[model samples]
Target: MDPTLQELLDGIGPRLRRIRQDRRLRLEDVAEATGLSVSTLSRLESGKRRPTLDLLLPLAGVYRLALDHLIGAPPTGDPRAHLTPHRADTRTRLDAVVVPLTTYPGRLQVFKQILGPTSEPPVLVTHHGHAWFYVLAGRVRLLLGDTERLLQPGDTADFDAGEPHWFGPANDRPAEILHLFGPHGDRFTQPD
Candidate 1:
């Protein structure tokens, strides 16, 4: 076996364990989701069984990760991140496109968002998290409870997500923003 291949294979076991632990998933939970037995998962994580495509495919789905990232493949020296934008408004009728900026499990998630005016009145929602929004282009209107504010370029707002809040373009035109959402008990670090 090539030395590089051996090294890559050796690292997969630890990476699997680390990803599972980082996502706060238990072995039983993984087994149930991936349809792989707990003992098999344990052996795979312990490097007793060599990883095959069949084993990794389901794990990748459950973890919401690309195969390359899952196995820690060497980077292709590409500076650009081939990000896929996903819809943010699944139930609500808000028109927005969200490109995920970070993918670390069980941690703060960041996104670049583009939003359009809403036809219906904005719906305020509450969730267990903290969010910070920064306007990158155009204008964004933020409605939190009874308070309403229009944010322009370079403007920022950080608030408790527990408060009823919804935000989108202030007018008919589109707006762009950099959004950061941190889950419950997420502590943000500041550079010294």
Candidate 2:
């Protein structure tokens, strides 16, 4: 292993100990919370034992620390900013460009979506966030909740993601659109 990696692993024990002490948590408490023996926790904190996923996952959950922070892995290379376009099943292609407008208590994310001819509607997935979309060209079929509408060029739509929503090409031609996804209770805006 690289010296840097070794050094990082060596320091995790002390870091874990410091974090635990900072939180005023006892080894026994952590052990009980994580189903680990107190001696095993001590060995882990003292660097006598290498931490593994089985050990770290519970500790991370208990301590409220991300696994990456717990293990001190080197920062990954820049998250690729450019999109890797996905071609649809029906001669259609999409380029989803992700843009973050702000990073604060709530994150605002945006995507520029382009769809080619015959793009089929993708399965609707529900996750944490609200989304809004605007069609710039061609037609878009918006499936939100129980309602489905065909948005002509220059049309726009928005809705809560929790209620389930999906969008794709409405015809045999390609379509292009801009989508904004807000996590902080922000609504989508469109021209009247």
Candidate 3:
């Protein structure tokens, strides 16, 4: 076997551990999210298990990184970002595709969300967080408490997640937005 290949393989375990810790995700959290057992993750992180595509793919998604980047592959000159897209579960029957934009551990989670038109009525829920979203395309309808507003491209909104709030497409077209949120009330921007 090539020495470089062996060295790369050997380094994977520490890399995985570092990334997981950097993301502030516990083994149980990763297990629950990835459906991988805690023991498996431990073994992988401890260098007792060999890395494979099936195992690394989900980890890459969880870490919001490209497989090559995650494995410490040599950098190509390509500046394009590789992101994984997943559906946003809005509790009710809502259509939203969430693509993470940033992966700063324990910091604000940034995502580009595309919310499709939903025939169902909006259902608001309360939580402990603050969310700021900027509309990038189409139209968005933000229902906050008893008030609702239709937002267009370039419009921005921020609110306490504790408030009963919900967002959806303003019309039949899907609405796209850049969403920034922190579940622990971490403010991304200062008040004007």
Candidate 4:
């Protein structure tokens, strides 16, 4: 194998171990779930044995993760974005189609969000970032702190995410919006 491939393979053991530990799963539990022996799983995590797809597929399925996620594969250098719209929650009719408008490791990230009517009341959450939201379609009900506002098509709002906030479709219809956020909690300064 090439040196680069060898290095990638060498890193898989630690990554697998970390993922298992992060999920708080015991080695025996993973073995039972993956139909792999505990000794085999231990050897795989400890780098005593090389990983094969036969071993990885079952482990990935048991961990509820993609094989690429398990191995920490580098992002493919494709320029175009592939957006897969999936159900965000089982209880609500909300479906999220997320498209990353920026590359990884960027200070600011942009997302195009589509939210369907929620079945439950919105739960406000506070975090440490600044966020901007621009409604593209339908009406969006934004709950920012004690203020409640309805945003129509082309409406925009920006605020510190430290404030209690939540948003969704104002009616039974779907709402599409653009969201931009600073990962490090940096505020977006408006242009003069």
User: Could you tell me every candidate's TM-score relative to the true structure?
Assistant: 0.56, 0.44, 0.59, 0.56
Error of 2 at 40 (Å): 61
Best of the candidates, TM-score: 3
Better of 1 and 4 by lDDT: 1
Give the poorly placed runs of model 3, Cα more than 4 Å off.
1-81, 190-192
Each candidate: what lDDT?
0.89, 0.76, 0.90, 0.84
Per-residue CA lDDT of candidate 4, range 1-192, in tens?
888778889999999999999999999999989899999999999999999999999989988888888898877786765564444552223456666666657578777888877678778888888999899999999989999999999999898988898888999998999989997787776799
Give RMSD to native, each candidate: 14.3, 15.3, 14.7, 11.5
lDDT of 2 at 25: 96
lDDT winner among the candidates? 3
Tens digit of lDDT per residue, candidate 3, span 22-133? 8899999999888899999999999999999889999888888999989897666654544889997887568999998876667788899999998998898888889999
Cα lDDT tens digits, model 1, 110-184, are 889999777888888888889898899998989988999999999998888888998888999999999888997
Candidate 3: worst 10 consecutive residues by lDDT? 73-82
- 18: Cα error in model 2, Å: 48
Model 2 C-alpha lDDT per residue in residues 49-120, reported as the tens digit of each score? 998888889999999988988777766754544454544342223333334333344667665667654444
Deviation in Å, model 3, residue 129 alpha carbon: 0.8
TM-score of 1: 0.56
